[model samples]
Target: MTRIGLSPLAWLDDVEVQRRAAGLRRSLRTRPPVGAELDLASNDYLGLAQHPRVLDGGVAALRTWGAGSTGSRLVTGNTELHEVFEQELAAFVGAASALVFSSGYTANLGAVVALSGPGSLLVSDALTHASLVDACRLSRARVVVTPHADASAVEAALAGRAEERAVVVTDSVFSADGTLAPLRALHDACRRQGALLIVDEAHGLGVRGTGGRGLLHEVGLAGAPDVVMTTTLSKALGSQGGVVLGPTAVRDHLIDAARPFIFDTGLAPAAVGAARAALQVLIDEPWRAQRVLDHAATLAALCDVAEVPASAVVSVILGEPEVALAAAAACAQRGVRVGCFRPPTVPAGTSRLRLTARASLSDEEMALARDVLTDVLAAR
Candidate 1:
């Protein structure tokens, strides 16, 4: 074959250089199956990822269902396990029905696209998750991005829109900043405008509300006719997959109209089993939710973070990508694992150490974390 003089892919090299210059390049590190480092980087808020029951559930499902889902859910992939999960999940969250998906991103995509089309309007929060942003883009609706957590802005968008069908989307708890959206106010606005409210409870389900039923449940909007909620099993549930909980009509419509739910393979048997087990664990140990929030508050205090975080995430802004990376490295060297978020994941000049609180973190681990984080911050 003739040697290509200049590959079209060469532009990637320049992009990589630019990223490095801005300290925005990202790389992954391989982690052992088990480690000695104190884990403040994971989203295992309830510490159920390695729970014996959760593990057993996954193992048993894997043995029974084999390795894969086999086909799309509409085909051979739907199983008794998936059906049971949907029913239990819907009941637990006070929804009339639920639809499971392979991931939270896909769930949001399906919900947004299925609910809104060319004649509809979608009002989204400016600081919602990337998945939601992508969903908004793919929705084929008239999209208006409102100021973060501004219910008035959402109302205005709805009021000004010509479309009769409108959907206002927001995260129950913001992922990066660990702040809560005004769900009750948003619901009032949606009701006033005859619109539907979609709340992403991925960060709220296991960390907010009474007994972790989620923010919507806490606010009495769980079974509201105009409200739809989506959440992930990978975070607080310490498993994998996503679910959309809403009215029975919404679920039926999604089954027939949502492309992601219809075209994608069903969630793996092991994930469904694990999530079901974790949900049961949450039900039995409701106090675990409060423990996670308490741990997060302790972590935030140790870092002098001013914001009272509403969930398990505690962000300590370091103001520069290199600074945040160095801080995370320092924590890791001290046997404390913390997450460093740079540009793209966070705003420029607001790079941060994103610490997650787990209910299973021991007193000894907490003390160690406090000391390590203090030293890291003092060094700055």
Candidate 2:
């Protein structure tokens, strides 16, 4: 037996193997133009991502604080803007406190890993985002992935795991299918089992609950001592960052123990400012929440009218991955941008076009989207 050299490392290829197994992988496109066609694929629920106010707020922060945080939160990076944003966020989301992170992915990673460790058991939904799944892996906790949105399955996983601390984690709105988790039922189960419930309301924050307070509050679990929620500012807020909100003690624990917050550079001042502004906008325009939900239902109804099986995402089911990709391509070609959920991203045999709705969409835009979607699906 001999060790492989750097030259042999070049021959060792997982990229080609994955390509053969999963087809050609997609690459990121550079900053897309706002003028490019109708967009039903982005997570900009309130259409505030490119709003003048948001841009101006971000620009002001950038000018005041520079381009990046000088250091991590525990270091010199903790800015006054970050503090203000967190306080505002906590108040808006009905949490005792909130801790902001550089990205929502890092926020989930830090929260999950810090809250549940080697002697802990983490039960998560099968349909959760990749970030949560990765956090479970990094936590070194005993991970039990239950059936998607099945509270009973979750309960069963915690039935006899008394030796270790257990936490039930789930996404409030699953990204791929746009389905919601049974937050109340999961909370009940966790409460019964003496476990903590961590709800990922990344998609839910701007789209669900009363006035977009989120699923946890809507289900009467927000202020609960045992219920913790994490959300992304990049979505509804149209800013880039993540925050974990819960009781003061839990937040204090995260401040001291969460590696992402302590070790990574604090969220940029611009992002914090933008998030603050976005939250303020939400407070002023409470109707935005209802608009997005209404848009989602409208998309679903149009799919139904077109004889397409639609879920919370209003996806046009394309049996084959290639078909889904092609459909997405066709939509893009027709100046209607949409999302394509395929293998690995979506569960096996559930490839489809995932179209998200926004409060900013005019009635005519939605009608155009429906027409394009129906035509695309029919052609497929």
Badly placed stretches (over 4 Å) of model 2 are: 1-14, 17-24, 305-312
lDDT of 1: 0.93
Per residue, candidate 2 scores C-alpha lDDT tens digits across 317-358 of: 676777788889898888888888878887667788888888
Error in Å for residue 82 of model 1: 0.6
Model 2: worst 10 consecutive residues (lDDT sum): 305-314
Compare the candidates by TM-score and give the number of the best one.
1
Per lDDT, the best of the predicted structures is: 1
Worst 10 residues of 1 by lDDT: 1-10
lDDT of 1 by residue, 1-380 (tens): 77669797989999999999999888888788996799999989999999999999998999999779999899999999999999998898899999999999999999989999889999999999998999989989999999999999999999998998999999999988888999999999999999999999999998888889999999899899999999999999999999999999999999999999999998999999999999999999999999999999999998998877789999999999999999999999999999998879888999999999999999999999999999999997
Backbone-clash count (model 2): 0
Q: By TM-score, how accurate is candidate 1?
A: 0.98
Clashing pairs in 2: none
